[model samples]
Target chain A: MPAEGGQQALNGAARRALDAVERTGRACVDSISAFGYGAALFAESFFWIFRGRSIRQPVRLTMIFEEMMQIGIVAIPIVTVLSLTIGVMLAIQGIYTLSLFGAESRVTIGIALSVTREFSPLITGILVAGRSGSALAARLGTMSINQEIDALRVMGINPVRFLVVPPLVAMMVMLPALSFLSDLVALFGAGVYVSLDLGMSLPAYSDRVIEVLTVNDLLHGLGKSMIFAVLITLVAVVNGAGVTGGAEGVGRVTTRSVVQSIAAIVITDMLFVFVVTR
Target chain B: MGVEAVNSDRSVLVEVEHLVTHYGARKILDDVSLKVYEGEVFVIMGGSGSGKSTLLRYMLALERPTSGSIRVLGRDVVRSRPSELYELRKKMGVSFQSGALFSSMSVGENIILPLKEHTDLDLKTMEIMARLKLEVVGMAGFENLMPSELSGGMLKRAALARAVVMDPKLLFGDEPSSGLDPIVAAAIDELILRLRDALGMTVVIVTHQLESAFKIADRMVVLDSGKLLVTGTVEEVRNSSNERVQQLLNRRVDEVELDPEAYLKRLTGA
Candidate 1:
């Protein structure tokens, strides 16, 4: 009887181990399929951008303009303040560290390169992700809950065409523009600090910044911002369009959208830096 | 159970065969079948969670069943591509439970959206069409109001205006009388009947309100626990011999003999 009990226990352990493996496999498959579904949705949205007019359901230019106003123009004050603050702090730290070695003037080089090639774009991406991405998810999730999306489907209108493409087109256009503005504002901020702290002339600081900044640095940051835009919009649209369970589900999906967009931005930023620096 | 054949002379606009649907692992609809005739108000009534809404969604082609054939307007909705489905949907209209008006758009804009998407009509003509629908729904001057600004009944009216703005050949309403006072609910029922008579549109509704169902429906199918209990005219359902149907009609509580062991297991999560 004891031997039989021992065998039963062994069999139970093996079965549990197999069950765990099966569960893990299924989870992986679910995730992969979800990712594939998201990709298809993204592709369909993009396709609608080009083909909508032929079907007489064009993505309205006025709608795109409204999105740009919401996503870009309305965001200006916050972006400017945050980027400028970071720029001043970076300059202060750069001067203090470099002055220890009697090389404080090289602070201009550090500020110009870092602000143009990295900090400005990264900050703008994160701001947009947190602000617009969360809003998109909430709006879409609520629409899903209210049956507005389903209503649109039954009306023969494509939600992606009417909803997703405007924000996406606006993001692609606005992210690069906003990054350029951020780079300029941050440099101006650093220039102000240099003039006040080091008793330098504004023109001299401007000359130093211009000498250090390359066209490629500007282009690279703009490119990164564009990719970040795609990531933020994609995550928000997917989460929002797929919401279930009602009001609480909207909150859950909105949080998930912001978190996922930020993570994607950071990881892609790292990959970008590794590639470009190499 | 009281089951009667649908009027063959009217011609069927929607036909479902052996439809089965599951929500995750739980069966929501089991081998259900029904037919809706053209130019008639066909109601699907049941207790909550009886899969009436699910069946409506299937007929709309908004969702696919696990196994079934659904023919709507003579097209096999199960296998239609998205493009074909959209084309089919142009002739159909649905009013959701809670209005579901696009919050961002004004009532006028909401009503004209389908026109803007599908037609090349000038702005003036589209606005005229929207105004006409608004007048029909008794909200002629509320075009500039946002959805949030409207009361619940007004919202439903605006939603109804949008649904019929395209003059669809078929209309589906999911619980149109819900969440309203009895008077307002009756008004909605009256408007639905008017739409059918005025526009010559076939109507399908999923509702649990027996009064509104009886008032608007020419024929209906009553469902319980995802199973169809009766499909007949109002009098047939009212006189159904099935105990469950009688209980539902009388609004009486069901009495089930308790199994103590099973009850204990359920209570204790065993």
Candidate 2:
């Protein structure tokens, strides 16, 4: 009886360990499956886009235009304001630090490089993640709970093709444009700081910015914005697609969409940085 | 309208055999089997939690059964490929209980959604078809209004318009007359009759409203506690002497006579 007890305890310990590993394995498989679904959705959307007028003209045009207005046009003022503020702040800090070595004149190059290459795209991504991403999640989540998704299926319309593709296409096209706007506004703000605060001429500041900014820098930033846009759209749509329950479920998934978007954006940004910097 | 006429030409459209379903560990439907013949309005009536909607969802291929085969329109929905399923769905339509109209779309657009997706009909033809469906449902002028703008009755009618827009061979309605006044509900019941007459359509309606059930059901099935208690013509079901069926039809709550000894054992966790 004592030996049997000992063997049973050992079996219990092995079972516990096995269960812990199985739990982790299940989580890993779940995450990978989710990613596979997301990638398939992304690829299918691009396929529909390539097919062009296969979708009715008015529907496709209206959807893409509406999404562009939401993701890019409506976002202009805030993105502009944020970029300008960051640009001026960077210039102020750069000049102060350089002035310790009497190199305050180099603030123009510093402001142009940092704002153009990193700040503008990152901030634009985060802002769109909060605004458009949350709205997409909430809207889709509510439709799911209301059985509108099922209605679409019963109607023979693929919900992902009909509802999600336009928004994804819009985000892809708009984020890069917003990033460009951010860079322009930031450089202009920095130009203002250089002329007014640092007692340098605007032309001189422009000259320094022009000298340091290269096509590589522009490509790097714009490329990052595209990646961020993909992250935001895929995360929002995926989280929204999986939503169950009711109104509270919609809210929960909206929050999850925002969180997932930001995390993915940061990780992808790091990968891009490592590639570009190398 | 007679049972013999229906059974004489009975070509089964939806065939379910030994179906079982579960939501988590709790069984919702158990070995329930039924047949829906073409060109008849088959009503599945049950009290709440009796798995009527689960059965409807299975027939619609919205939920998969744990152990069964469901053949809809001669296609095995459980084993069909997605492409095959899509083709099969194109031949049928389902109107959900919630109306399930696209909120962002107007009533006209919602009705035309199926046509827009499946057919290359010109906009002019589509518009005419939408208006025709709306007129049939007694909502002719409500085409321009959004779903949110419609009353409960109007919403149901508009949803019906959408469901019948394609004039599918089989239509599955999940409570078309629920939550409306008797007059409005009666109108919906009549609309179902009109759809059958106009389209030669087979309909499967799931509802708890006895009045609606009696009005349109050519053949009816009564479900009690996830089991089929009776499947017969409307009059046959009305005459059923099954105690559980009687309990449902009369709305009698099953009275539990409790024993203190059993209650004590349950509470003591023995």
Candidate 3:
């Protein structure tokens, strides 16, 4: 009986070991499958975008307009306010440091360079990701669980073309537009802080901002914003369009969309800074 | 009308031969072979998880079978290229169980979707066509309303309107009468018949509702446990000698026999 018990225990251990190996294998397969699915979806979106553009598949102009208004126009007030605050805070911190070195007047150059080249685009990307990226994922995820995506497929409509391209085009247009507005507002904010709090002339602050900002800086910031736009749109769409498991899945993927978009934005921003600053 | 009054010269519209499908390790359809005739209501009836919907998906060319062939409109669905499938799909229409109307678009927009995609009809013509279909579905004045505003029955009707708008050669509806009251269910069933008769489209409906299935099915295919149990006329199925067929038709659940020792061990966690 004792020998039988020992043999059973050994068999149980082997079974658990096999179970662990099976679980690990399943997880690996799942990860690879998800990665492959996301890549394929991304490629399909682009195929419809550039190829379908030339072929003249009916693009919904109204939807592009609507998404543009939602992502860019509706966001104007909040983006403007947040950018101005960041500008003021950057100037305040810079002014304190500059004062210690007796280089107070030079703070405008620092504020202008940072806001135009990095802060404006980065901040706009973060905000849009939280606002519009999450919205896209949540909306698409709900549509998916409701079988609207499958319905589109059965109707001979390409889901990527019908559902994804409008937001994509809207992002391409609006992200740069938002970034431009952010740049202007942040500069104005820095000017306000310099003239009022630091006792510098408004005209002098403006002159320094203009002097510090080069054509290269403006292009770099806009270029970064454009890439950020693509990342946010694609990540949100992939998460949303791939949702399963009904309501809870929508929530789960929505959270994933925001988290993934933000991480992608930060990493891309770091790379852009590394390359562009060099 | 009995079987004799229905024309016997109809051509086959959809053909499935020895079809097999699997979901992971579990077989979902096993050697399910059937034919759908043109201008007839072919109902595939089964309990949940019996693979009727999966079969419909295959017939619609949205899924591939593990083995065997499905030919819709004389084209092998498994071997068709994407472009070929798209062309074949244009000849077919499918109404989903949940209506699947674009929530963002009004009912009018949904009905005119296929027309806009496949035809160069002017906005006025599309609108008129959409209105005409809505009227046919008894939803004439509800075109401007969004999908969210429609009741379940109205949503299903509107979805049907959208499906038939392009006058497809074949119409596949999934669970048309599901979640409806018997009266509403009967009305949808009648609509299916009218569509088949008027449009001359082959109709394939996958449903679990026996009453609706019996009321409309010209010929029925019954599935159980991912396998075809029987396929025959209503009377033939009613008179079937097969134990599984009788079990299903009489709404009897099979008793599962378990070893008493094992049952007790599981229950007592010993």
Candidate 4:
């Protein structure tokens, strides 16, 4: 009887282990499937953006502008504030760390390179993901629940074209602009800190920044911002369009969109850094 | 259901054959087959969870069935490419139970969305068309209002305007009167009939409201537990002798017939 009991216990442990393995497998499959769907959505949105006019379904300029206003213009203040703070913090930190070696003046290279190549784009991406990505998810989720997406389909308006493409074009236009603005503001912030704390003149600081920074640095940050924009839009749309279960489902997908977008941005940033730094 | 009476002269617009659908392991539509004739008001009526809405979705080509075939406008919706479906959908319009107007756009913009997408018509012309549709739905001069600013009845009217704006050959309404007062429901019924008569669009409505179904439908199908129970005119359905149909019509609840062994198993979580 004791032996039988031990066998049963061992079987239970094996069953639990199997269940856990199955769960992990299921989660991985779900993520892969989600990624594939997002890719398809991205492809379709671009197809519509580029080829819609041939079929008399030209992407509406008005809708794109409206989306630009929502996703880009409305997000300006927050992006500015956050970028400025990051810039100041980076200057302070760079000064302190370099001062340990009595090389505080070279903080110019550090702030200029880091802000242009990394901090500005990364911080702006996070802000947009939180601000616009969550809203996009919630809006599309509510539309799914309300059957507006279905209505659009039945009306012969491809939801991807009518809905997704405008925001996509807006993001393409706006993210780089926002990132560029973020870069400038952040540089100005760092310059302010350098001038006030280190007794550096504004023009001297500007000359140092201009001397150290390359056009590639600015373009590289802009490129990363555009990539992040696509990532945010894709993640937001996938979660939104997949919503079910009414209002509660909308809320759930919105949260998931923001969380997933931030994760995507960070992971992609790491990959980008690896590639560039290599 | 009398073998789905065939009208030899009328062209069939929608035909479903041996349709089967499953949500996970549970069958939601079980080998259901039906046809919708052109230029008729056909209603699909069933209680909640009877797969009526699911059937409507299939007919709309919004979802793929697990098995069986659906043909809409002579196109195999299940096999059609997205471009083909879009072309087919241009001739079809659907109004969802919740109205489903784009919340970001005003009613006028929502109504003319189809025209904007598919046509290069002048903005003035589109606006005029939207206003005309709104007038037809008794929502005249309300085009500028947003969906969230409207009442339930007004919202449905706006949705109807949007649906009929393109003068689609067929119109599908899912439970148009499910959540409204009798007066408003009756008005919606009148609007559906008006749209049919005025625009010559065939109508397919899914509803469980017996009175509304009976009032609006020229012919109808009754579904129970994913199985089609009957397909006939209102009078024919009223006279159906099937026990379940009678139970439904008379509002009688089935008495529980418990199997002692099964009950014991359930109680013990066996």
Measured by DockQ, the strongest candidate is: 4
Docking class of 2: medium
Rank the candidate models, highest TM-score first. Answer: 4, 1, 3, 2
TM-score between model 3 and native: 0.93
B91-205 per-residue lDDT for model 3 (tens digits): 8888999998989899999999888887788999999999988888888899999999999999999999999998899998999889988788889999998887777778899
| lDDT string, candidate 2, A122-229, tens digits | 999999999999999998998999889999887777787788898998999999999999999989998998799878888888888889999989989999999999
Query: Could you tell me every candidate's TM-score relative to the true structure?
Result: 0.94, 0.91, 0.93, 0.96
Model 1 residue B238 lDDT score: 91
Q: On a 0 to 100 scale, what is the lDDT of residue A3 in model 3?
A: 100
Q: Individual DockQ of the candidates? A: 0.85, 0.54, 0.75, 0.87
Per-residue lDDT of model 3, residues A1-278, tens digit only: 99999999999999999999999999899758866776776678778867875654656788789999999999999999999999889889999999999998889889988998899999999999999999999999999888788888877788888878888889888998999999999989888988987798888888778877899999999999999988898889888977889899999999999999999999999998998788
Better of 2 and 3 by DockQ: 3
**Model 1 residue B240 CA deviation in Å:** 2.7
Backbone clashes, each candidate: 0, 0, 0, 0
What is the Cα-based lDDT of residue B201 in candidate 3?
76
Provide the lowest-lDDT 10-residue window in model 1 chain A: A30-39
Interface RMSD score of candidate 2: 2.5
